[model samples]
Target: MSAALKIGFENPVAQSQAVFRAVMMALARPGTVRRLDVPVDAVPALDPAAAAVALALCDYETPVWLDPALAADLQVQEFLRFHTGAPVTEARALASFAFVPLGGEVPALDDFAQGSLDYPDRSTTLVVAVEALAEGEGWRLTGPGVAGEGRFIARPLPADMLDRLQRNHALFPRGVDLVLTCGDRFAAIPRSTQVDA
Candidate 1:
């Protein structure tokens, strides 16, 4: 087995708890960047923050869909499976979570699972690995978690991301959420967020 497959939280319980808290805070305060402190050696073709998110959030109950680039990486697959126990799937709509790499082609927003009105929480949550993440001049975000409006900057998102997010927001109580990661930092953009480019 490769080193990456053996690399997981040194202290599974505490590390996972920290990562989970960071994830919750990020999602609770959209556009706010939170750092994940888990120690992960470089996993080939996998961003550390993305790996940490998967370790914290995915489990047997959550079926994950990987982008082609990530899906082809055996090390990444092994690491996630060993640590998260998440089932991998090729069907996007059936996925409860999806991992997409920066600069890769992303599927249409509608392609992911958008939960029914009765159970909006069943929708997929996307963990996107980006080149960089910072607060500055990029998309403007406003909605539930924002005090007023917040600025978020991440490079190489989908060309039609803003339009898609607008439409996604229109879905109201039934749309996917997003977690953007770069290195050890991540931020969230929930379905309740409105994005202006």
Candidate 2:
């Protein structure tokens, strides 16, 4: 079969539910790495975890924005649209969810919607495919989900990632949340988390 027609979750409902739970748990425990073992046929330009995020969270109502490389891949577009029914958007600010590659050029956090004060939850969820995901090292994280503090790391992210994260955190109740994925593992850094750069 063509890459564009690649299968999504082997068991749609069950797999999506499992992936969703993993993603939520990661977010709720900020800096915690969760494994997404959902079986999915590879889609061009997207890591398995990234595709899992889309399948579990995206729907017809959510508009998605992909970085240049991902956006340019027609097969990736078809696979996502077919399985998730998410619209591909060109305007970053209009995106409900945006995907970027850590090893490639990534847009500034501000580029995506920072929802209004009255509707901060409307902000975009940034899903970044990174080179690595690990715990107990790198940036020190603290805030809500964290008990005392947590350490998280992702490789090949921009050199100014910490600065960008600090700025996003400063936005408080109105900034985009982030999910970093590598291979079949993923982790989150919600805007509420403070990064000790």
Candidate 3:
């Protein structure tokens, strides 16, 4: 089989379900890292966790936008299209999910859809590939899911990540959400969470 056709959940139904749970739990407990139960073979310019997110959460109804690095890779595009049936969109604001490969340039928070006052769920969800996910000195998180505070440390983050996150959080119900991925591990920081450097 071609490489593009080779990447997807080993057991479509069961594995996707597991990945879905892991994703939800990551979001439910902001700043907490979760590892995917099943392995997702890496695509040309995509991380395993990012691939898992696309396979498990995206479909024909969900349009995805790929960063420059990922968009330049035909095999990565074909793999996502073949497995998820999600159309690749050029307009960032119109995408339901945006995938950014490691070292890829991330657009400004306002570049993506921020939903609206009446329907906040319409906002975009960013799946960003990072160098690593670790504990210890990093951005401090609080609010909603966090008890008192939570630590989120991912390398190669945008210099103004905390500022951007603060602005996103201020948007409350109408802001983009982020999922940071590395290898097979992932973590989330919803719009409801507050970030402090």
Candidate 4:
């Protein structure tokens, strides 16, 4: 194996708590941007926020699926294994979580684990690394979390992302959730959220 990349929280327990809280808040209030504060240098081929999320949420019990570029990077693989102990999977449908980089052709929503009507929580959670994440005009989100409507803007999303998300929402309690990451910030879009582009 290649030399493991240096990346992980300086104070693993405390940092993980902070990251978890941020992620929880983001998921609770879908489309609300939140910052993740972890004391770790950025790893090559992985976004800082994405790395933070992995360290916060993944463990031996979780199966992670890396996108093509990340899967080819030994440094990232080693770093994740050493720090998170999360196993990597070759099957997208079996992944508990998936890391998808920006500027690539995102995999089809159906390619991932959509869970089942009886156990919707078993669906995969997507951590999408984007070039930028902001609150503005692009997609209008409305659901349980939003007081009225939530607006989120991320550049260079998949051409059919909105349509796909809509379809996913239609699946009700059986679709995947999404977490958009950029640098040290992120936002969530649960499967229950309604997306209008």
- Most lDDT-accurate candidate: 2
Cα lDDT for residue 197, model 4? 78
- TM-score of each model, in listed order: 0.94, 0.96, 0.96, 0.95
**Each candidate's lDDT (Cα)?**
0.86, 0.90, 0.89, 0.87
Tens-place lDDT per residue, model 3, 82-109, is 8888999999999999999899988998
Model 2 accuracy (lDDT, Cα):
0.90
Model 2 per-residue lDDT tens digits across residues 133-171: 899998999999998999999888888999999999999
- On the 0 to 100 scale, the lDDT of residue 100 in model 3 is 93
lDDT score at residue 39, model 3, on the 0-100 scale? 75
> lDDT by residue for model 1 over 66-135, one digit each (tens)?
9998899888788888888899999998999899977667789889999999998889998888888888
Mind giving the per-residue lDDT tens digits that candidate 4 earns over 1-197? 66556858888889989999999999999999998766666476777888888888999999999998888878888888888899999898999999987665679887899998899889899999888888866799999898899899786688788999999999989999999988888999999899997
In candidate 2, which residue ranges exceed 4 Å CA deviation? 1-4
**Residue-pair clashes per candidate:** 0, 0, 0, 0
Q: Using alpha carbons, what is the TM-score of model 3?
A: 0.96
- Alpha carbon deviation, residue 49, candidate 1 (Å): 0.8
After superposition, candidate 1 runs with Cα above 4 Å error: 1-4
Q: Model 4 reaches what TM-score against the true structure? A: 0.95
C-alpha displacement of 7 in model 1, angstroms? 1.7
